[model samples]
Target: SAKHSDLCERRNIYADEKSSLESELDKNLVQRKNELEMTLIDARIMESETLVENESFDLELIDKRIASFRQLLEEKDAKIDELVKQQTDQKELLDKLRAAEDKQMDIINVEAKTSRKIAIKLETIEKKHNECLRKLSKMGTIPSDCDNNYHNMSLKDEYLELQKCKHKLSKMPSVNQKALDQLTEGREKGRILQLEKREIKAGYESIQRLIETLEHQKYEKIQVTYKSVSKFFVEIFQRLVPEGKAFIDMVYKDSADSGSAGSQASGSHASQESQSSGGISGAGLTPTFAQIDNFIGVRIRVAFTGKTVVKEMNQLSGGQKSIVALAFIFAIQRCDPPPFYLFDEVDQALDPFYRKALADLIKEMSRSSQFISTTFRPELLGSAQKFFGVKFAKRVMILENICVKLISDCNMN
Candidate 1:
């Protein structure tokens, strides 16, 4: 019995242990089922949120597409409206053009009818004129044998003037037919002579006035030119020679006025002399032309170095004279600048310093005018833009760059 009791106790203990283990396993299975259900719930919620977001984005995109389509429709509607307006304007213009065409047709028809009536009236007038001419011819009273009136008919003013003259002549004093005939020839001749004399006198007066006008213009031009050239002369001379200045002194025999008494007297004297001598070509007039028609003359005055007083041409040295001559040429050129200039050793007589000044002057002047200079000085050659030397052999020209050929070619020429 003790054995049996011990065995029962053990079995009971085992049964308790089995029941505890089964309870622990049931708790674990319940916890695991709850975790799985939570996981499935989370996944389902995420999928639903994702689907809602996607639908929202798709709806927004669809709304944007619809807005774009609506905008395109609006643009098309505006274009259609503009086209409709243009069509309406074109139709109105077409209607106006048709109305103008009808009005023009009416005016053309009226003008055509008026032209036909004028043509008929002209024909009737021509027939009456022919009949009048025939009757006048039969009576031997027609002033002109040829009775052509077509040209006169077109010239209403001339025809009216002829009619007035005829009326006046008819009202004049009567005279013996034979005496009137004799006086008519003399009167016509006298009238013609008188007209010729009047014409000659008028022509002479016109020519005299023209000559006076031309002389006045020439005087003014000379005064202006002299002033310009003189100013340039002084400037150029001073520039070429730092301590020198030059000027052109103008000497006039009279007041330099075309209407001056001295001028008139001189002109009259010249005319009388020319006539008396038969021709000015054969006259013993000086070939110098230093008189300038006895109107004016020019004298060059220059001063160099310590000489402050202006000296005449004979007073200057050779170098000073060359400088003065170059200055004069440049002065005249400035007044009427040419396209180009040709100078042959213009600085030959100039000192080294003056030669440099001449080169600078040429360079400055070349800004406005081109210069071609044959120069021996290195000072001028330095300022040259292009240097070319010429050689002549058998009349053939050979060009080289700044060499002895320069002098040789010039000697040949």
Candidate 2:
């Protein structure tokens, strides 16, 4: 009986322990499920927050870009407006220039016509003067104007003036005996005055003739000098540049005023003249002495290379311009050479060929004239007979004659 009781009690204890263990496991599973749910909800909230923050950042960046683009567009528009205003101003300036050009043309035409008329009158006066001189020469010994020196008178003019004076004095009251004597004295003085007037007129005419003669002589001298200088320029240019052709030409104020360019201007005088006249077809308004008449300015025409078109001195390179100037000096020296020419680094801008040519030319002409030149060119050194150098000692610069061998050494130092 005691053993049965102990067995029942043990069975009851095992049932309670199994039930309690099952309840504990069910509570743990429920708690674990609640924690998982809470964690998933927190993760979703964090994801949504991150998405909202990302969107806000993107919107701010886009707004900034749009503002920058708007500013850039405004700047471009302002630039465009400024350009348009400049263009308008340029157009207005061009129109004003055109109007001024037309006015200048009309004035030039009027002046040209006046010049022609004056020339015709001069010719007529010259003929009359010659005839009068021939008649007077055949008549007696030439009267000396020194006896009665008067200025600016004519015999015919004096007679007319005397008549007018007599008419004015005729209305005066009758004169007394003393007044008669005074009138007689006045008449004698008038006769002497007429003789003086004749002498003065003759003297004035002689002076006029002398002026005309001198003017002709001046024109001839100008022509001769131009020809000689032009010839020398051609020779020197040929020596310097065998293939290059260059020339000096007179640039007329009228041609520039007319705003005309020569038609078909090449390396010839005829072409240059046509260009100077602006190829005016109908009026033939070109002057015969247009090139030589006005001594306004001179221009240089050159082609540095054989194949290039001829250009003005203003169009040449710095080196080429220096070469041209050197050639001009050579021409002047050959024309009216001085005792000695002082040159300061004359070969600085010269090319090798030009330097050699210049040295050779100088050596050739050295016998006629002396050249005191300063140069670093070996060509000039080879041709030189004397050299000079400067020494700096104790802050003092001293000039001394240096030997040919020492020149290079001093330069190196």
Candidate 3:
């Protein structure tokens, strides 16, 4: 009971403290509201003073901003008008483009119709061509195949391809029909040219054979004549120069075992043609039978005492050359047996011994051939059967007979 009474007393005390704190909080709240009202009143007074001081400047700035905004709006209006004009022009151009495209489409439709007609005709022709191929296969004109897929080709694709080919062909140069028309004539001319070439080839072969035969005959003839003449030549030279030997040498360009005349000639006709052309640039200058050293030439080799040395005519002594020349003349005469010979001072450069030998040779050869000599040598003059001397006149020569015999021969030596 006592604890309860004390608790009531503390509660009354706490209640009294709470009432005092609540009253103090209310008073503080009222003071804060009054201070806020005073601050609002002071701010309103400052704001009114600021508006009064800067009102003219603010109004001028607002007017300037309005003017700038109006200028920008006018510029934007001009730009909008230019854009609208461009848009109208573009609309008109689009309409014209659409009309031109429509016209082009109509022309394309017409061309497509024509192409379709052509395609129909080509299809008919292709059918006929296939039928003809079938017939040809049956007739054994061509081999038949079961899988001829080419016949099933799309007409549209083929027509498109043909159009492309035609376009390409049109872009190229025109056909030269005139040159094509001359094809038959050209073929005929070509045939004639071929025939002519064959004929020329045949003729060349014939000529080559003929030349071989002639060369062989000439070689044989020279060989036989050289043999006969060498016999006489050695005998004559021995009589002139004791212990002397002489002979004629023959050289051949080709081998002795050349092919027979019956064989086909392996020699080229091109070489013959080149020879006929006679190029000076040495372009076709290959070695031939004629180009060999001393080919078909008769060279005389002679030695007065020992084995014969083959020397050129320029290398021999004058008298020795003269003897050789005379020997050759005599040899030739013996072979052909000429009816007469007219010699002009043939012993002019001969040595005394050779001169006598020449005179003796003339006397010996005189039996077979008549020797007419014009000489200044006493030995040859004494050997003459008939003598005629020339006495010079002003404009003429007088012929007088001289004694044919030497004085020592007529009497005693």
Q: Against the hidden reference, what TM-scores do the models get?
A: 0.43, 0.49, 0.41
**What tens-digit string does per-residue lDDT give for candidate 3 at 165-239?**
568757765664345436767999999999999999999999999988887676567556756675566667766
Highest lDDT: give the candidate number. Answer: 2
CA deviation > 4 Å runs, candidate 2 = 1-186, 260-293, 406-413
Please write out the lDDT profile of model 1 over residues 1-413, one tens digit for every residue.
Answer: 99999999999999999999889878997788889999999999999999999999999999999999999999999999999999999999999999999999999999999999999999999999999887554433334533464444557865686688668757864734245445777899999999999999999999999987887677667657766776777778879877764545454454454444553344434433433432131121322333334546665666675356556687788988898888888888888899999988888888988898998999998988899988766777767777786789898999877555554454355
lDDT of each: 0.73, 0.74, 0.69
Query: What is the C-alpha lDDT profile of model 2 across 54-147, one tens digit per residue?
Result: 9999999999999999999999999999999999999999999999999999999998999999999999999999998876554334347723
**RMSD (CA, Å), each prediction:** 17.7, 35.3, 35.5
Candidate 1 colliding pairs, count: 0
Best by TM-score: 2
